[model samples]
Target: MIEESEKGWLLDNGLVAYALRVGEDGVLEHLHFGGSLGSLAGFSAWPRQAYRSLQIDDRGKPFRHLGTLAQELPFFGRGDFRSPAIAAPGLDELVFESARKIEGGLDLGDLPSARFEGAETLQIRTVSRHMGLEVVLSLTLWPGHPVLARTVTVRNISDRPHLLDRASSLSIDLPQADRHIVHLTGSWAREMHLQRHRIETGRFSFGSCRGTSSAQHPPFIALTDTDTTELHGEVLGGALVYSGNHETVVEKDEFGAVRLQMGLPGGMRWPLAPGEAFIAPQALLLHTDRGLGGMSHGWHDFVRERLLPERREPYRPVYLNTWESAYFEVDEDKVEKLARAAKKLGCEMLVLDDGWFKGRRDDHTSLGDWQADPKRFSRGMGELARRVTAEGLKFGLWFEPEMVSRESDLYREHPDWIIGADRDRPGEGRNQLTLDLSRPEVEAHIESVVASMLREADISYVKWDMNRFVSDLDDAKRAHLYMLALYRIVRKLRKAFPGVVFENCASGGNRFDFGMLCLFDQTWTSDLCDPEGRLDIQSGASHFFPLSALASYIGPSPNHQNGRISSFEARRDVAFFCGSRGFSLSAEELEAHASSVKETAGLYTSTQSLVTKGRFDRLRTGAEIIWQLTSPSGDEVVILYARKRSEPNPPFASVRLRNLEKGSAYRMEGSGELWRAESLMVAGLPMPHTDHRANPPLMKALPTGDMATALLRLRRV
Candidate 1:
């Protein structure tokens, strides 16, 4: 135990700020403050027992009495002072250590050596009220790394037990927050009105998150008036509040941003027994200035160029998959047959989905063996890869690297490898255990597996799948630490297979977020492949993505995830309008719809640039309508019109096309209708107006003008 005076720190405001060398760099590593002290007991920080012995009082004060643990701090004075003559500097560089407390008084614990030896400082402060607490804290800049972090600390200075009725409050500064886009839990928040005084809130709905405004009128604010039960169908709690003026913004002008965490420390039923404390994690990210202009416009540009730069221009996957059509009885012959068919159909790639491993007929076993199953491919993966490449198509494979079936050799060898409360507790996700990425052995195994497969075959694409979420994370209490370990694993895989394209698929889009996107090139948007179902998913995703980065691969009409039969025209329109467009249907299914399939393929190739790499514009949408997407150059515009029910199109449904140069020469290709750029820009389009309003119940809004609308607009010098 150390004293405040000895530690050279002070506690004043409703927050804490400190200065210390966190790691290799002399950068200020971390700063922590705020949250009721009682909640700190629930956390699992370093020197576990060090905090266990401290005493806390009814006023939420922390103190230490003697050698042994106590429920209350020994009384000193009205305003007592304590300090150690000699102590550790840069304590935050590593774990908390038991050093020569000013006077060599108490033992902290066996702490690791600090990574950096530098002057360090600590401070804790806060202002608390019955309702909640307000906090503002800062730590000196260390300049060690691109970002800095701090561990939450709770000291119990009091003797009585307390119950915290609420969660703690954490806030982070968004210096670039003004320009950069931010997406939290499936909704995007744009800068609406940044005022001088108070932080006003705005709303963005889930399915309607693309443009500056959401489809819903009341709009979707990051935080709500009350606890929201409709957030992605989960009873989610918490609100996102903002402060600072919009006019005086920070963008390429700022260097770093501050982050804050405000929430009730867990187990807040503060019956916080005297000697306990709780701590939570603070997650943040700092980025370079690209398109900070909300909706990830600038961010996506960077992502395409930096994060996923292996492929030349976005390689929209025109793929042939074996999941739905071929489940268990897939063999070399079947794969070759499919690849040939896929090539004939002009598909760019061929993917062997599952059941191509030794002793792996079912989902119950053989995940550890990444090698091709002899029975499925007698010639092996290398031979198969060469054959596929010979047919002028790329080869892709699937792997659930994070999971292991109980019957598998890996799990049988190391039963303890799976994460669980105890050895007896059953693991989850198809009776499998999550490979602990924290374990160096697990990470090495993943690396070995990836290396072996990449080396064995001429594989160009990989669909990385994580089928489930973690429930019991016992290795450590801090969830972010575990997440950090997982991220490291991804980095290892990516570093090893730099040439192989990796697609993130978390049981089909449940874990879809910017964090994951930052690592993998493309993400399987959703398992929901029905064209209609995808509209919602794609709309929500496009809020913060470039259409080129989105994996808009078309699957079978009656998708495995959702049973909805949609026309090939609609599917191609939606899929090609985004990044990669492909199909997962069987050769027979596609062959049966031969003419339509060919047309769809041709359409994708014709408008690949406009759809995959074009500037987007939201035309119009409301309760039961949506018409959007246009090219950067005014050459073409792809529009879709749909009605809620088969209702007569009401009056005039006007959609204003954006990004048109007013004074340029323009001509509509369909009717050979020559119109000036100014005229088209002003009048917009009265699409299908005649057929839409003919009858009330039978009337439907359909796309007009041409199968493909191309308008030539001359660029102004």
Candidate 2:
């Protein structure tokens, strides 16, 4: 829905609107970008020249100043003194040249881009006076979504090369400066926790300078109204589709205007030779009047439809991974026993994690040597895979493809394959060195080896893990180069193994980003997957990623990560909300909880379509975390509740329902109680109690203890 007018252009998709017009000085001025107004009537009428104040430009015309107006891309050397979108000399202002509307999106050359199908793109071309630099700012709009993608391309038409120190994919000037920034910041197992603060008069910036987008700071930010909540108010969010070193900045200028920018970090030096063009990473802006849920649903739907359409549509498998069960000791005999136990538990796949490779007794050896350990797998890796598949289940194999051990055959033969192979003592994380994917030989080696493993076996799933970071990040260019190469290899592998489901795991949640989600089908949510400990991690991740892509698995009691002993039911209840379900249990514990495991797996098979792919809602209660889900067709409703710790004689625990038809009546599944949708939404659903509401008095109370969990299901009647 791109409507070009005499002034500029109007990009609307029924949900979000973005309009821009040429100013008096022939500069592209941003008119409106939040909510839709139905049409482009009287949009940039007076304000194209109305924002003049006491101060004036060098030419003495007050509104001629670029600093006062909202621009498509602000300049540094001209009148604007704020943070420029790109750091390059001789960049006066991007004077408006022409804007063309076309079907599908603009091509980003070699960079990874979102789907161009069914999307309308507006490319506004501008040029500077000094260096003959051409700037094309692209905005892509989807039909029924409140999300828009933005990117900037710079081409050097001049004879001289230009040095670009910083380049952001998108930059916008908002009229308001008073908004709170909501960002996710945490460490390894503790990833994607929501942290927010009100905007003030200074620059508040955060980003990941680590070679990879670190677990400390993910590449997402939201500017919300002060009264915004999980289900209400205004939230304008920005997410970068990049997996490398990145930066997001929210700055408030002295004139009370806030500028938001997302793209590459400021530390790298990028040279653009004559006739060369540089394309920044993509940035998605989502506007939602329904607050965070609306923002979240927009991203989730985009990921499903535009990002990984084919990969996301299938039934996410329920598997039993052997990470906790056998760790590095997962041999052929161990895998056979686990496959037997997994089949009885109704698991669909049995993933052999870490330790099947040649000479790989531990993480410190044989990582890049992608072959079966002859001693452990007496027959071969393929035979073990065949054995698992023969036992009425699919097989999954784990590989740290991007890492190499110095002691392995791959590293020994080609030491130069490592990131800093020339150094005498190159740094290492997790006792392994990162493969230099930037090298063509390295990519070919990894692709050939991993593909050979898949060809030899009936590998239905693959868990791709990267246990280390780029330790030699003295040059920021290394991060972006490695990412580009990694993307190329991932795309090749995806095309080669069309039937295999690939899950990305970076020590858990480090690669939990949209850039990877665009390639990998799913991600291991976290290594600390105990139900209670994962409450915050999963909740925060749900704000951005769809449940279908979050791998939430139930681990052993006295949790392997945190040592927290939780009930089997509690663990299963928490894992139910995530789309990709699985468990990692020892042989003894598998026998002990066989009935419960099979029953829970059966319930998952029955309700997964409704619970996993549904529109999820977060309702907050002080000490309890609750998630409500609505089926895509609007007939079924599911709620998962967890109490961190219980109290004696606690207050009545009830929570409101959302997103139901007003006149509908739903029958609660277990209790067989019928309730009207309006009453359930307005009056709320009471937590099950020991009262007479239960036919039998003095019955058990719901959520009765620490790490307690409860589930409620309602079907439309």
What's the TM-score of every candidate structure? 0.62, 0.96
Mind giving the per-residue lDDT tens digits that candidate 2 earns over 1-717?
888877567888889998888877777788778898667876543344455565447356655777767877877876677777867776766788887888898877546777888999999888886778888899999998888999999888899998777779878889854689899988878888889889898788888776777788889988999889887889998989888888988888776778999999875777789998888888999999998888889888988777753754568768898988878987888899999999988988899998888888877888888889888897998899889999999999999999988888888898888877777899988899988887888878888988999999899999999877678756666667788888888888889989899898998988777788878888888888778778888888888888888887888989888888899988998888888898888888889999998998888878778765788888874578888889998799888878888676566667889989999999888768899999989999876542335433322346456888778888999
Q: Whole-model Cα lDDT per candidate?
A: 0.46, 0.83
C-alpha lDDT of candidate 2 relative to the true structure: 0.83
Clashes of 2: 0
Candidate 1 local lDDT, 296-324, one digit each (tens)? 34334434433343456655557777887
* Cα RMSD (angstroms) for every candidate in the order listed: 14.2, 2.1
lDDT leader = 2
lDDT: worst 10-residue window of model 1: 241-250
